[model samples]
Target: MSKKLNIGLVGFGCVGSGLYDVLNRSNLIDAKIKRIVVQDPKKERSIDQSYFSFDINDILNDPEINVVVELINDSASAFEIVSQALKKGKDVVTANKKMLAEYQAELIPLAKENKVSLLYEGAVAGSIPIIRNLEEYYNNDSLTSVEGILNGTTNYILTQSNSGIGYEEALKSAQELGFAEADPTLDVDGFDSKYKLVLLLKHAFGITVAPKEILNVGIRGISEKEVAYAGEKGYRIKLLSRAEKIGDQVVSFVAPHCISDQHSAYNVHNEFNAVVVEALFSDKQLFYGKGAGSHPTGSAVLSDVSALKFDYQYEYRKAQSNGGLKYTTDAFIKVYIGSKYVNAIEEVAFYSVEETFQSAAYSFQVGWVKLEVLFDLNLNARKDLSLLVLPDSIQTEKGLSELIEKNLFIYENQN
Candidate 1:
């Protein structure tokens, strides 16, 4: 049995409202929102005025509020609210991925110091129970790779683009449908997925990596040309976030990949998300659910609230047990680079070129390159190139020759 929860909700936006509704309507938990805090008091909302507070201290200073749920848009403000609440010995549930990604190492320790649980299943993959599973089940398994379509907005846009709509039109549709924000830079540029990936790295590999260290490329650069190529090759363009352990080091990145129909991610369209966890004896496992939306994300938040009732806290057992596993980009990746100019491909300086194709519309090459080279290219802000990571099977010379000789590799001229 758990104590009745008095929650101080720190936002009235989509997710906050959704949580409030579910908590009030459902009989799943003994929780109620004692007070709600908002930045702009004048902003029209569905709730009564008396339930809202203009000052965060109203909730932070309240002794009745045993739990703090932070769902604000600004990462800095969310961090402040969560940290203060934790210092006050209040259990916290937050959906601020950027904040957690940036300050998880510090925040996790703070929670332990205060003897309070800091849970953020809502921050990662919306409704997917990934963080909890990684903490509970996969922690004991020898996980080789954890990859998925972690961003709903980018996945939605890519789904629309695959249906023959242009990227701008797809983005506009996503925005209009509220699947994306007015300023969708975070989602479209892959920063959102990268933040989630950072959290996944911590839970999955017991590694703490800076979000910037990963090579994150979103579907923003994916033109119809790539979409056509994917269709021609019986593949779907999905923004994939992946972290794989190679030897003693772990390599992670977020980018657009050509997923075949056989892949679990191929059918994960719109606001859906999927995670593929591959382990030694466990083989492969998939977790799929709504990646974003008011109810979907709110359900995750409510679950954390319910968890807080029984004093559920992430043990971070893997982080404590795994030793000497470092995050690195000093790896070789098989990739397909498509660009309008051939020089852009040459500048990558791939260790080996497996295939090259030239045509009037675009030029591309499939080869192996040091992951650091691509990371540097991104840092240098080269804007004209689109890079796609190829599967590991084609990394060898024999496999590359077989793909080319069998006419399996798709090129513009070949079509």
Candidate 2:
């Protein structure tokens, strides 16, 4: 606790380099500890020679290193590395949201059993401080719902397209700006948001739901008609990660939503991510900032290091006593086969709410129903089917304040 904390870096990638630079910089915290870069000696693993290097074994065996900072992006070795470090009695910090979200139940218990802190401030919202903020400030107040634009690549693409640019132009601009990944599949297809949602589910509600439970739908299907209509109606098209406790069940998804100017989510344009969490106190709070990349995300990692080096004594954490939740899927008013499954089931279960009764939009099922009924599901309907909770920008006249107010109010008595 006297000198700087020793950092054992598992990967020398962009985030790893930012961590190295932060700890070593003279003007900042004046950290005295040095970071040792653990490399696969068998691989080229090109990095500055000045960085301390040894086989992965050297890091696990080195008693001098009391903290392990994991920046490795893959699941295979990341699992092994963090597992080994916790067993060795070292505190851990990581930015691998994908691995953390998928294997949290497997490792969180291990870290707790070993009396070591497994910190992941950099895993979500980059520099937004969303994770610990909810974990520390909103305990016991029933986080009834949490939603955000969690992936920057999709956000950037949608934001750019909102200005009249097409998806191709927006994607190219995002790639050029470094907001989109080179391959961009995970971020574009909503896998990245799904991974981040896993972290939110665990941290916000103490619900250890897997990424698969919540439907993951990318923004690729967002149409020009939708965007143009939203823009005209005073809304922004964003790939929103929305989760809520509906009636007796919890339901979540990643999809395009039209948010109004009244919501902060509409302001989170470009690569920024924003979260609106409904707490038990009947409050809906907003946290916003850049969602990813080297500097900002590394800043999140450094914040964890600073906490370990100076404040772990005061940090309080509590895992749910029961620690088990059955996933919720009961909110399905309508169910259908996806468009991709169109060849399988021609007719699907389609319900028109009291609010959307006039439009008469019917859902098609590729695998679940007979080929004929797809034609008449919407023919019978009331004129007032509930508005589909579409984004504000998309539906100029629609409002979610009633639903949002309902969600926020549920927490008041409980908090």
Best by TM-score: 1
In the range 1-415, model 1's lDDT, one tens digit per residue, is 7888999999989999989887878897989999999999679989788899989999999999999999999998888889999999999999999999999978999999999999999999999999999999987788889999999898989999899999899999998998898988899888999999999999998999988788887776787777877788788888899998877778888888888877877788888999999999899989999987788899999999999999999998888787678898766777778888878777778877878988867988887777777777872245688877766522233444565566554664588
Local error of candidate 1 at 395, Å?
Answer: 7.3
Candidate lDDT values, in order: 0.87, 0.67
Model 1: ten consecutive residues of lowest lDDT: 392-401
Error of 2 at 230 (Å): 2.8
- Candidate 1: give the clashing pairs: none
Q: Global lDDT for candidate 2? A: 0.67
The reply for model 2, stretches above 4 Å from the true place, is 1-4, 26-35, 38-48, 52-54, 310-326, 333-348, 353-415
Cα miss at 33, model 2 (Å)?
A: 5.5
Once fitted onto the true fold, the runs of candidate 1 whose alpha carbons sit more than 4 angstroms away are 379-381, 393-415
